[model samples]
Target chain A: MVAKRIIPCLDVDAGRVVKGIQFQHLKDAGDPVQQARRYRDEGADELVFLDITASVEKRKTLVEMVQKVARTLDIPFTVGGGIRTLDDARAILSSGADKISVNTAAVQRPEFIAELADMFGTQCVVLAIDAKRRLGRGNRRAETGERAANVESDIAREASPTGDPEVWFEVYTYGGRRPTGRDALAWAAEAERLGAGELLVTSIDRDGTETGYDVDLLAALAARVNLPIIASGGCGRPEHIYEAFVRGRADAALAASIFHFHRYPIPVVKRFLRQRGIEVRP
Target chain B: MMTRILILDYGVGNLFSLMSAIQREGAEPLIRQEIPPDPCFDGLILPGVGHFTPVSERLRRMRSAIDEVIERGTPILGVCLGMQVLFDRSEEGPGQGLGLIPGAVVRLPDSVKIPHMGWNRLHLVRSNPLLHGVPQGAWVYFVHSFYPQPEDESVVLARAEHGVSFPAVVGRDRIFGTQFHPEKSGEAGSLMLKNFLRLCRG
Candidate 1:
């Protein structure tokens, strides 16, 4: 059986590790290499380094910083942000990243996902979707705080004949700054068809809040697509991570705050999950 | 003398992880597009992260050279798609594999996720030098949509199941292949690489 993955996401600004609430109010966390090594030592299954300042600042992802961090760990590493073209992705992968994730550029041109998957097999192409619940009139469930009875209802609404979902997750781009208006679940299915081997679905509304993962979003996406989903955003506690696995059906749970702030060490979280009968790496 | 391992690049994907892992295990890793004519390195690794057809086409160009390396008794370790190419062919695309191992690659069952991405346990089939320190049911990382189906079951040293049972590790004499990425498999992977290096030392 494939064990559920516990990934530590490091939001890098310039080159240092930083954590922000809802992708704003950035605060320096630690050095990227040091933090990455610490996570590896803590028994993290994987690491994701998102150069938060790259796309917004028009600066390239720090290749030097990526190389430094990649050299310290033996596990898989994924780098994202500022990866607009194949050359940009090549630089990061060559520097040692096992996978390269694209968000903003991919949303702008959905074909970029196929291009990346074609150039570098789908296995290494990860589509990072930043989605927020649409609380507008069309999504009454969000406004009224009405949760779907289960994943089945969420799927039913997503596939409703009217095609106007009462509740929908809107895809966001530019690191959660711009809403693309694309339904998150629909985009994920399209991404899978475009050859994306995995989906890193991050909830922009719950990002950095440490509240919990958008289980509805994750469960909905998981049901819609066969690709492995990595649940991101929220995650205040080990139980939250567990919820992402059991309720959300996420193959992996990615967290930054809890891991970065030492609120819950990876081993502690893994132990917590293991005790709950979750299959985790020992 | 320090063991030197030549990792065939093929311009496929990232070789840094595999190279760094080997270096950490006390082996000097040299990257090259083509296999050196002489068995200069103690072992060779065909790193994979690309489509089957393109990668197979790339490897087919060095077929005779690779065969010569194997003839010289140099161990070759193929990983993921690299392992797929050791077979006679693959269902992923139209191309001829190295055929060093008599088998064909087939798509993983659809009952599971396509890529089968994540860590899974390895069920030991039989002992080989590659399984030296690896514990039974040890977990390893995998990221591929297809897996090899060897013609002879004797070659299979270990197996793993996603939706169905499939060979996870196969070894026949010096040539070995792992469906999983040992380089990225954390400790168990490190141990397997160390064992491969031990084989190279001899």
Candidate 2:
């Protein structure tokens, strides 16, 4: 049986690991290479390094950082954030990152997903969807333009067997700063059809809150697509991660705050999950 | 003498992980686009990551050269797509495999996720020098949509489950292949690489 993954995510800014709450107020954590080695030694299944700064001037730094991490760490790691073009993805992937994740670029132009999957194969292309629940039915505004057209046709072509979603999660872009007014579940289904290998769904509402993973959001996305989903945001404890797997049905749980601060190490969390009957890598 | 291994680079995905992994195992890794007509290295590694058809086509172009190396009994280890190309064909696309191992690469069953991308335990079928010191049910990382189904059952040394039981490790004489990326599989992977190096040492 495939073991459920416990991933420790490093939000890197300007080549240094940083921690942020709800994608704001960044705080320096430590060196990325050191942090990565520590997590791997602690038995983290995988690691995700999101280049939160991903600036044009900082691209070289990010690539260099990836090379260093690749040389030092044996475990597979993903490099994401600001990867809008093929060149950006190539730089990171060739430098030794096993996977490349895209969010805003993919949502802005869905064809980018197809191009990436065609170029690198879908196995390495991950679609990270930053989503926040729509507060009320009144807040649910219909999306406009190409995305709206794509979503409507996508829904009609592959209508959910479970019927329409009871509550809708709104898709947010530009690191959760812009709301596209697009349905998160609908977008995920389209990404899968567009050749995205996996979906990393993060809950903006619960990010950094430590309340728990948005199980409702995760279960809804899992129900909509067969692609592996990595549940992210709002993981404060080992039990919270267990909830993400059981209730959320996430294939993997990605946490930052808890692991970064050493509140609960990866082995401790894996032990807890293992005790609870979760198949975790020892 | 230090073992020198040649990693065939056919313009697939990254080779840094595999190269570094080999280097960590205390072997000198040489990356080349073409295999020399004469085998100069103790071992050859075909890396993972890439579509089956294209990679297979690329390998097909160097059939004679690869066979020449094999004839010398230079131990070869294929990883993921590398392993798929060791078969006769793949469902991924239209291309002929090297057929070093009698088999065909087939898509993983749809009952599970399309890409079996995560850690999974290996169930050893028989003991071999390649897995010498590795446990019976050790976890290894994998990221692929298709797995090889070797026609000769004896070639399969270990199996793993992802919608169906598939060959995780296969070997015949001096040729060996792993469906998972042992380069990225942490300690279990490192130990396997060490064992492969030991095989090369012979």
Q: Which numbered prediction scores highest in TM-score against the true structure?
A: 2
Clashes of each: 0, 0
Q: Tens digits of per-residue lDDT for model 2 on A1-282?
A: 788999999999989999979998788999999999999999998999999885589779999999999988989999999999998888888899999999999989999999999888898899999998764433444544536655554434433322344346778898989887677877898899999999998999999899999998898788889999999999998989999999888999999999998999898999999999999899
Instruction: Give DockQ per model, in order.
Output: 0.76, 0.79
lDDT of 2: 0.89
Q: How high is the CA lDDT of each candidate model?
A: 0.86, 0.89
Off by over 4 Å in 2: A136-146, A151-166
Candidate 1 colliding pairs, count: 0
lDDT (10s digit) by residue, model 1, range A44-146: 9899988877544445448888777767787888998878999888888888898999998887778899999998889889999998876543443332221
lDDT per residue as tens, model 2, B91-146 = 99998999999989999998998799999999999889999989989999999999
Work out the iRMS of candidate 2: 1.0
Q: How would the docking of model 1 be graded?
A: medium
Model 2 chain A: weakest 10-residue lDDT segment is A157-166
Which pairs of residues clash in candidate 1, taking residues 3 or more apart in a chain or in different chains?
none
Candidate with maximal DockQ: 2
Interface RMSD of each: 1.1, 1.0
